[model samples]
Target: MAHDVQHYNLDQKFDFTAATKKGLFTVLGIGAILLIIGIIMAIFGGGHAEAGAAEGHAFHWYQRLYANLWINNVYYTGIAIIGVFFFAIQYAAQAGWSAAIIRVMLSLGNWLPIAGVLMIVTFFVASHDLFHWTHASLFDKASADYDSIIDGKGAFFYWPMAKGTFPIFFVIRMVLFFGFWVFFFKKFQSLTYNEDLAGGTSSWYTIRSWSAYFLIFFAVSSSVAAWDWVMSIDTHWFSTLFGWYVFSSWFVAGLATMTLLILFLKGQGLLEMVNENHVHDLGKFIFGFTIFWTYLWFSQFLLIYYANIPEESVYFLERLSSDIYGPFIFVNLAMNFVLPFLLLMTRDSKRHGVFLKLVCLMIIAGHWVDFFLMVQPGTLGHNGGVGFMEVGMFLVYGAAFTFVVLSGLAKGKLVPKNHPMLEESYNHHI
Candidate 1:
């Protein structure tokens, strides 16, 4: 597998500050639109919330639809935001090959604050509507006067505690996730920028320090965040490997997204410096992480299915029963595992821009399924499938997602010319 080096024709002093401002505006605009639409649907979801009614009960199909969309929106936000972690870790390790795309990752990573704000607002607005656990009054331990579903998990569904602890921890963790991202983003971004100008050893020293701290941060926090934000939607089900499961899904998807963005930019007549070698690395990551994702998915499923534990088995049970969801589960596996496993195995395929981009698209679509499966079960319950609301919301968020990324490109110089590994990345040929 050999790749001929390529170079961008853009000015050496490309200014991305305008692009960054534009992207920030686009993110805010799209996010604002989504927030408005989702809220409207959530508010009009049912007949109405009676002031004195304790055991509020109503079924609004539209509300369910809005909820799913909102969930997906929050999820995409989380994935995009967590990209900061990817950037920081790579920088901390002083990874040479990825230096070319570090600036792009930073642009995507900077979307964290906007995403986080939307998620928090959505949580409080419809807290009871989404999680049974959020409605503590519904779970009366003393008598059979309350909701049975909530009663089933009353022990862990402590209202007072959830009210106090849930938001506190969720916010704290969000802060931690972004706080780490911001610190590293600044440190590395600064170092990379400075290295470009100064050509000093201090840049390398700054990056080296991040690797040790990053692994520890990732190990402790990734699982906790996954458990609370993602796995907890079901509240009843739990998986020890859930953290790795989420991480693998996002890792591949995130890499593929970066690849797609580069290809997309190239189509728009930019990123000329990005070449076949970069595509090859992106393809390999897409392929490798897809396999890693599959391994985790299967390992978790096989063990849980074999154990036949009621608590664990229910996670899969919901998916196995639905029309849209059941088919989606298989598709997710096929795209994330079978397709990439076969396609990326051949060396030439990874380096071919057209082939690589198509497969990257497949991986992204598949992981969307991955996140959908993890969430839709707890959300829509039995026999859930595609509806107008889902499609409509997808339209809204998908556009917003696109707007955010493109606008973000103009934020800074596309190439991290000062990054210590920039030259290595530009010269890389594996």
Candidate 2:
């Protein structure tokens, strides 16, 4: 069986039109309005304390909104970061099928550093509402707000010498994590771009070496990042598999985004080199990671349930006990696991463009819900819901994400001409 050896014009670049930017910014502008309104409501509107009620504190509307925005920022930023990892793994492994779409992956990765900055800003703004450890009174023995558990964990999250949970270590760790990821993201990106201008094996060797080390650094840093950013919200509850769970969610989401973009480009008469073989491989990844994510989810749940440990079980109890969140737990599972498993299980389905796109959409939404479940229950308790505020914040963040990535995509050629595997990628077949 002979497959058409498609030819690509390596000189072709994406022309992200001015109209597109205007439209995205308009959406972003609307989202900004909504976000501001949501923030005002949360700050001025009073409600029963959803978190920190033990010391007679009640959670404000701002705290819930902060949690919602934080989740969206982290979730979307994570997808971008994972794209770099996905590209790195492919480059390191010398995979040929993904070579044709490397630029798309690179564009996706350019959003990581920006996301890091946004996260820092949001943290400073909502430190009081999002992070319980930021409270000074919680660590004081003479203070009525004293928390023994948080005080004990001070060395891990706070400045040990200062004797309070002021988040010195936590903030430093955030800087380090994003700094390293951005550094490598730019390093690899520069090398790949240079390869297009100066085609040689020297750059490839350098990239391979950097990617090898990056994987190691990424593994440790990503896990610790998960602990600091999300898991630490609950403060008392801990899970060994939380890092893997977070990684799996971001990984699948990133692949889904890539797949959607590829399909879109193909429909636009661009990326003629990308064929069904590439699509099939992406589907396989989405399918495999969905299972991996489900495995970790179940493992985390079953152990906590069976052991009935007060500390571990509290996390689930908080989420499950909430009437608003209880139904979404099952919904999250169904969208992330059941839908993908059933849809992409067969070879034919993996190559079906429309079906794959639908599955990708579900996976993206499902993981958003997954991240929502992970953070909201801890921060907002039962106060959280999917409303206009949440939708507006998502639009604000999503429009920005789309704008940044598309801008990056337009800066470089759509394909890497100098890539050694270019020919193989163009001819890739199952």
Candidate 3:
């Protein structure tokens, strides 16, 4: 079907019709209401002092909000960063089949800088609730709140009081991570746009060269970013594979997101260049990464479980101990690993657009739960519960992300007309 189209003449611009704008706003508005309601539940949800609360050992309502906010922020950041990673890899490989869909990845990559800003703001706003090391008393030996474990790792995450700085190391690392991603994304985006105009190998060469450089930077920064943002939440617990683990989850989610978007466009009669061959490749990614994510998940779990180390085991222990999170721990594994592994294993399933989209959505939601388990157990302990706030925040971020990515897609040509591989991509087949 795709071979019949000698050239893609579809409107490259996204039409933000009144209905579309209304839909986006409605989602955002509904999210806001849900967020407010979630906050109320968090603040006053546990009616009368329960077992933990009655004992004066309960986590406060604000803590739950802080935890939820931080986790969602991290989840979105991973989604955005994965876009840059995807683009960088394709450029590095000089792969041609993706030239047409490259815009979707680039548009997705555009969200990183914005995600960076939101992450920084969230850290500051929820510092007390999220990181114990952020508190001055945690480092003060004389203070009752002093924690030796936090102090031990203070050189990296904690700033000295004499410097009168907050998150100096943390903030610097955050800035560097996002700065690296945003800088390379814009450079590559410009090269692609320029290639659309100039139609030469010069822009291509530059993109490929920079892609190699970006990948190296990604290897180090992605892990560190995960360590800084997510791992640090469990300040006392540590994992050697945490960075890779987070990266796997991020990569799969990114592929799933891009896949969903492509399907949506195809349904609307756009992306005539995109065929089942393209969808199949995407399914392979979602399938392969789902396993990779599971491997890391189990590897991390197995190593910790077998070693039986108190510090490391405590992370899972808290999650399992929680009435709310206990079941989700299995649910997280099932959605991310079990379901994707089973559903996407077949060749026909990968070729089926509808089935692949359903699996993609499930994997995306599963990872959210995976991330929620990673976060809530460490931060909220047994105090947390699924409610309006969690659902609403998901909508809020989803709406915001959709708006930004679509706006980006609208700004550029839907097809990379001048790309050297445009023909190859249009005729791609498995």
Candidate 4:
């Protein structure tokens, strides 16, 4: 059956209404209240000192706060960059099925600039509390605190300067990655907006060229970033698959987020060109990557578990044996893998809004837990678990991220009106 092009309004723009702003602010306010309550509880709870004493260190409430910040920082940053990544992938692959919804993907990058600042600031503020390698004494050969293992890897974080000084190399990588990501996001944004105005194939070709370059840069930078940001937290434990593991988690979460947004717009009676077919494609990506993430997770875990290399096995021991985090290991697998696998296996489920919505939301929250598992075990030791602070911090960051993405969406055409593949997207079918 031929679809009528006139049935869709290509020029439609998202209206960022007062009601939407109020709703987001409402969530933000609730998150703020919860955050304050969590902080108060941490201050008065008084068990951290005992826990810290057991571990031979002093603990503060603020360390938990910083850990929460770092978790959300890495989690949301991945989602944001994944948006640009998915957008670039569509263009580079010359995919037509997503042309109508491509704008939703790019809108995610709007959060990148904000994420960059939050990540850098969080690193500076929470370095000692969160990253074990950040300790200066670890590099002092004469100090009892020195770790020869960390010292051997010091160049990864502190090259071109003395070890244990400032992590100039690590900081540079952080800034450089975000800088290039934001640069490419803006480049794509400009080209797309210009294409809408000019209505030519030129912009599409140019974007494809740029997308190839961005993907090449991302392939390298994303892995290095996984090492610099998350893997380094467990300074002694390393995995050959850590980078892929992290990227797959991010990719699935990004897919889920994008699917949710598309559903939201569809419910709002926007994106007329988008239909069940487009949604199914999104669902398939989420389902596929969820398994990919699980594969990497298991691959990383199994190798260490079977080898029983004390250094490698210690990483899993920290989580799997802990009363605090042990349950979440299964929870992470169940949510990210089992549920998504079961819920999305049927073709009808992928095409249905309600089913897709439920699974996507779960995937989004599930991946957050995955990151929490990755960071908190290393940073807070037995001190960390999901509580008011973790929940509140997640809500706060989530609300803020929603605001930025929607604000960007409202600023431009929701559909890429002049995209060369617009007609192909209109006729998209499984």
Candidate 5:
């Protein structure tokens, strides 16, 4: 197909649509098995810490509860839920640079149901680690250590928060979150597909309506969802900044993933609908939001650290005290912040697909480290550094994430052909 140099660039068809290796899915299968075996081994392997003397409290199998499970499931599955609706957003906005890769975003977004299932499963597993509020002492009013926070809050945060509060209420909320994505995704997906079938403003009108509602849903749900999952880890500690923090990291990471995946697809000869223009746009995003995310990171850290408030400061204090985390704190900031900030500052760098690719790779790695720094110190404490558990967790999630995106690419046309501005996008050279 010869592209007209003026209004059209010969649309290059990407030939590489690699079949997702059956092995990758199988590996998740094996991981499920190993996860089960590992859980059991860990359980029995501990053959007996004397009751009430382990890790500042008694270790009980029953700690697994409703809210705990909810937290875990939402975190793991949220990438899909949030990703799809957001993709819809960029499209509804008629964003040109993002339009080329919108198909993959839709595909990854569709994986929300699967991710939701994973979230539910994690909730079930989490019931064991959390839910100490069920203890007789907390509710009995007889235990001296019992505080009003636990007792007064028990019915709300403890029982309801646990794995089985009101099964109906719990499932409804989860369903609603997933439902928002499913419905919005279908609306936009149908509209986009329709654009290809019928051109003009018809698709744009439908997309714009869907996008407005989607943003409403995105703002409300992301806030609640963040609290339900990550913030709940330290139920006692609160941060109004928490939700924004989660979004900053996930959004940037998802975009970087999109850019990298596009590059990978191009390498394999697929997404022919995409070209350097598309890549350049993605790179520009890499350059722009890399800075935005860093701002958010600094804002959060700066406020929390300077306030010197015990609750907020403890979060940082824990990180600095730990040998492993103490050092990575700077490295984490450097990669996620300083480096991307400096490197991606140039238009030339962003326009250079190869340079942008490196910047994106750096961003992705940086976000991973960000997650590591955020999670490890809190969960594993000083004793837990980057070890097998962390590595395995990364491998399992990383592979799963990869397989999901590729499988999504295989689902539809690589480029949205009938977008109202797609012609503009194709001819776009800036």
Candidate 6:
């Protein structure tokens, strides 16, 4: 069958209009207001008194604030890195269908440098409040608060230093991972921008090579990152599937972000070369990975539940049986798995803008809840729920993320004009 190849303006750049900026700023202002209100309520509402009593310790309102910070930190950071990771996957697999939307994927990396700074700074500021192992007494044998399990794992965070002192090794790993990620992002950005001007396949070959290396590094780094950032929050509990579980959640959320952006651009009459076929493939990824994420979640939950090990089962017991978080557990599943699975199952749903948009938004918010469940139970005990604070922080992070990604998108050629497989993407039918 002969296909009509549509020609596109190779030099087209995204117009980062003042109107769009205004809209984003409006969202930012609203988010800021909500955040302030949530803070005031936390201070005056007496919500933490119950939580403190339940946990046998004084739970400060600031701890809940810090937990929210960490939750959005890890959640949005995952979304950002997934962008770069997905871009690399395209080149490594030599996939042609995504060529037209490749730049959209790369734009998410623009948040990485900022995210790295936030992750490090938040860790320093909120370490004691959010991370259990950061308490020096936990590592001190003479202290009543000493933890044998955490002490045994001390080298992972404090090697070359006393277990109770500072987490030199952990900090180093954090720095090195972000350093490498930023380095690679800059490299990819330079090469792709150069490709636009030079118009040759040399950059393509180089990118494929670099993509292979990035994938290799990301495979190891992403897993370790999950263990460090999220799994460690439940200091006493560990899951073999936690890394993949976290990765799958991030992957689906990233896919949703990408789809939403693609749809928004289409509404703006940009990326004319990207058609329903491209959207369908993206939908398939969301659909497939939603199931993948569910599989990982169930595997982790079932194993712990079946083993009935006090150490492992306690993790779920804390959330599942609690009045504060039990409802959210079902909400998380419905939004992340059940809803996306059913909503996106149809071919028409995958191809249509309205359905895709709805599901993408749900997946994005749903995964945030997933992260909320993971972080809050461990850090806030029964203190946390999706209150004004949680909603406010998410919106703040969401607006900032959107602004960064869109600003980056506006700076680049919306399409990879010189990409060798551009024609294949134009003719993509499935």
**TM-score top scorer:** 4
Order candidates by TM-score, high to low: 4, 6, 2, 3, 1, 5
Give candidate 2 misplaced runs (Cα > 4 Å): 1-6, 29-46, 50-52
Collision count of model 2: 4
Candidate 4 lDDT over 1-430, as tens digits, reads 3357656787899998899899999999989889999999989985455445623688888999999999999999999999999999999999999999898999999999999999999899889888888888889989978899999999999998999999999999999999999999999999999998998799999999999999999999999999988999899889998889989999999999999999999999999889999999898899888888988888888888899999999999989999999999999999999999999999999999998999998998999999999999888887889988888888899999999999999999888888888888899989
lDDT of 3 at 69: 80
Per-residue lDDT over 301-320 for candidate 2, one digit per residue giving the tens place of the 0 to 100 score: 99999999998898988788
Ten residues in a row with the worst lDDT in model 4? Answer: 46-55
- What shift in Å separates residue 383 of candidate 6 from its native position after superposition? 1.1
Residue-wise C-alpha lDDT for candidate 5, range 1-430, written one tens digit per residue: 1244223323344332334576676666665565455445545544233333424654432231223233224434555655676676776676765666677677657567676676756655553343333344545556665656546644544445442233334445666887776777777777777777686787777787778888888888887767665565554556887788877777777777777777877777765656776776776666677677778778877898888899677877878877678888888878877887788777777666677678777776677777666654444343334433343454466567767666655555677766656656655676
How many residue pairs collide in each prediction?
Answer: 8, 4, 0, 0, 22, 0
For residue 221, what is the lDDT in candidate 5? 80
TM-scores for the candidates: 0.80, 0.94, 0.93, 0.98, 0.80, 0.97
TM-score, candidate 4, is 0.98
Off by over 4 Å in 5: 1-55, 58-78, 130-140, 150-171
After TM-score superposition, the amount by which residue 153's alpha carbon in candidate 4 deviates from its true location, in angstroms, is: 0.5
Candidate 4: where are CA atoms >4 Å away?
1-3, 50-55
Model 6 lDDT per residue over 1-430, tens place? 1134434676778898999989988988888888889889988886555555633578788898899999999998899889999999999999999998988999999999999999999999999878788888888889878889999988898999998788999899999999999889889988998998898799999999999999999999999999999999888899998889999999999999999999999998888888999999999999999999999999999999999999999999989999989999999999998889889888999999998999999999999999999999888877788888888899999999999999998887988888989889988997
* Superposition error at 169 for model 3 (Å): 0.6
Which ten contiguous residues of candidate 2 have the minimum total lDDT?
1-10
- Model 2 residue 415 lDDT? 83
The lDDT, on a scale of 0 to 1, for candidate 4 is 0.91
Candidate 6: regions farther than 4 A off: 1-6, 49-56
